[model samples]
Target: MSSPPEIGTAAAVQVQEVEHVYGTGADAVTALGPISLDVPRGSFLVIVGASGCGKSTLLRLIAGFEQPTSGAVRTAGERPLPGAGAGVVFQQPRLLPWKSVGGNVELALRYAGVPREERARRVPELLERVGLHNVAHRRIWQLSGGQQQRVAIARALAGDDPLLLLDEPFAALDALTRERLQEDLRLVSERTGRTSVFVTHSVEEAVFLGSRVVVLTKRPGRIALDLDIPLPRTGLEPDELRALPEYGALRAVLSHAVRDAAG
Candidate 1:
């Protein structure tokens, strides 16, 4: 298997002092601001913070789902374009219940102007990559929460985009299922070599999966701490990696940063 790329190596995405606010005047709420970070090409970058810290809001800006109220956001060295090389997996599966699992993935390709024949071929492959091949013919309702999220991930990977943005995609799963899916996601990202920015509340999950983890402050968020996870990128299972001393220390540091920011 090919090695995952180095963190902060190629600059896949950059956000500079961006700010986002909703509503106007007295009713206004600031979701994120003065936030800046770079996600390197083929790296796994995770953002963690307390609720209302703008983790998801910052992700939306990078995914081009929303524009910043101030400053700048760029993807692949250019201004972010909605759904451009930005594949998103939301907390919910958000799949069309009427479509089969493979059909759901195919729909994403179809929307991206992929030909029908190509969609048929690519959908099953993407599903298999996420370990969802057996469920390709299953309906969305037939799968468990974790399986549904896998299908959602398959749909996101269907476009073969350079960047994948996930917002707490496994936050709803049972503990065991979430752990299993995390391993699977790590494998998928490794195999695909796609740069990913994941938003999560779990410091352990962030440390386990990210090449670098960035902790954000409370509302009107800014980077509080950015840490490099120095575990070997190869030949280590997810469980084994968690048991490493470096992993525990990194998690502790992140936990402190998150708690301090929240306080």
Candidate 2:
């Protein structure tokens, strides 16, 4: 796998003094920064905060879903273009009902301009990367919720974009399923060596996945805590790693930070 840029190199993403607001005049509500952050290439950066703290809002700005009301968001030092430089996955699977499992991914590959002949080899390859094997023929509704979400992930990977932005993509799953997917995601990012930014409310989730984690304060959000996680990124099972005292310490710190930020 390709390694991340050297520590002091240009960041893969740069959020410079950005702020976002909704509405106008007296009704306008500020949603995000006046906050700035840098995400280095091939590192997994996770953003965590209480609900309504602009977690999703920040992720959207990075994805170029909406331009910030102030400041700038740049991916690889260029203004992000929605659906171009990044691949995004939302909380819901949002798969097309009429499409088969493989079809959904093939459609994404098509949009990504992968040739028809190449799609045959790429579809299953992407699915297998997400741990979905041999279910390409299944209908969307036929698979369990977890399986559907896996398809969503595979489709997102089909874009083969440089950055991956996920907004609580596993937030709705059962504990077991969510944990499983988290491990899968960690492995996939390692294998692909992609730069990723994930947003979530779960402290454990943030600490588990992030190479670096940032916490946001409530309303008109700003950075409260920005910390790098020192846990081993590879080796050991997820459960084994989470049980370490160091993991518990980071989780506790973020949990408290989130509560205070919600004030």
Candidate 3:
């Protein structure tokens, strides 16, 4: 199935002076924002920050899991509602251990209102896009951590949702697995050409995945830096991309900004 089209005149996501406070009175903690951003269609936008910098908080607003205390957040020119028109993947691959991998994705398709006949065609195709093959009938727990996460990603893409919200989905994997997943995800994003908002703490990961990167400061999590990554998004190997002088330079700039923002 084709991905959804961008809606209206606004970008895929629009955040205008959004501020989120976690409590009330003197004890209230402001977790994020009083910030704004615009994500164009088909953009791979990565948000990076130190721990406590509210990277995930902003992602939640985009995902409609939480609303801002002040201002507004919009997906496709409307107020975002959880599970509506967005697919989310988290730090853990939150799959049902009892279900086969294909079952999990098929369920997501059902919820997305896809007809049963279509889901039968889409399940394996989605898995293959994420570099998984022939394991659709396997139990979720029987797979490695990386494979489980791939299933999570396949489920996210089930509905052909125009926006993909990922909050550090690769953070918990081993180094090698993480890199492989990154490669696979990069390819998936390229293939789908859907808007993606990914939150991560790793500067390298941010540079590697994003066509654009937003770095957040600590505490109230203001935008510290918003950069457009100029590296080629495709047609090159992971090592070849990383070896470019521009790639290292972008990493250095973001690394220093992250430290400064954390401080």
Candidate 4:
């Protein structure tokens, strides 16, 4: 088991007065932020909004892929650095086609600086954690889309990075597969106690996955609504939690917020 993060410690991610613009002058387009947020350790934070609301752009800034036009974003009290601060999962699995399932995760472990012997030992364990057990030898093309995504998730966890950043990771899957993966991811996050930031347009997903959900306004995204979900994260099935009245209420509010923000 992984060690739990200390309670009341500094936030895992902090964004301050952040804004992002594209191009410049006549063609300049303001894409995101002038927003601020603090994500506590071990929290599952979901940012939801309409298409083009800059949800993904905000995520990129947090991941250190892009810098904000104004303001600052810090992870672990320093400016976030690409390939250093967090493990990221994108909408597509993007696994290497030539590598076997285990090879993909092994590569991540190697990049994380795990020794060769340790990487071999850790690969299977990571696959199992993402529920891809016994398929470590399968080629990427042989697996279903959902299964490939599981490998992507396993690879993300290979380093045991303290922060997990996902950008619509389940958006391309069928509804049933998406729901299943959501449940699996929630369990994984609870077990590992990693700080997570998820970006999606689905209000239901935001409420279901987040310990806290923030809705962003339309382009030049800003916080439209910020809510805390107090639903039990353990000892409850996914369907049962989704059926809760509080869950519905939160989803409804987020849905409305997203729609209004888009207009």
| Best candidate (score: TM-score) | 3
What TM-score fits each model? 0.93, 0.95, 0.96, 0.95
Q: lDDT tens string, model 1, 1-263?
A: 12222223248998876778888899989888777778879899999999999999999888888888877778887777887888999998899999998889888998889999888788878888888756778888999899999999988988888999999999989999999999999999989899999999999899989999999999978889998887885899787898889888989999999999997
For model 4, where is the 10-residue window of minimal lDDT?
Answer: 1-10
Task: Give the true-structure RMSD of model 3.
Answer: 4.7
Per-residue alpha-carbon lDDT of candidate 3 for residues 1-263, written as tens digits (9 for 90 to 100): 12223335469998887888998999999998778889999999999999998999999989899878887788989989999989999999999988899999999999999998999999999989998999999998799999999999999999899999999999999999999999999989998989999999999999999999999999999999999998975679999999999999999999999999999
The residue-by-residue lDDT of candidate 4 on 195-250, one tens digit each, is 99999988888988999999998888899899898987578888889888888888
What order do candidates take by lDDT, descending?
A: 3, 2, 4, 1
How does model 2 score by TM-score?
0.95
Q: Answer with 2 or 3, whichever has the higher TM-score.
A: 3
Model 1 whole-model lDDT (C-alpha atoms): 0.87
Q: For each predicted model, how many residue pairs clash, with residues at least 3 apart or on different chains?
A: 0, 0, 1, 1
Clashing pairs in model 3, backbone N/Cα/C closer than 3 A: 18-34
For model 3 the local lDDT of residue 55 reads 90
Stretches of candidate 2 exceeding 4 Å from the true structure: 1-9
Q: Which ten residues in a row have the lowest lDDT in candidate 3?
A: 1-10
Q: What is the lDDT of residue 114 in candidate 3?
A: 90
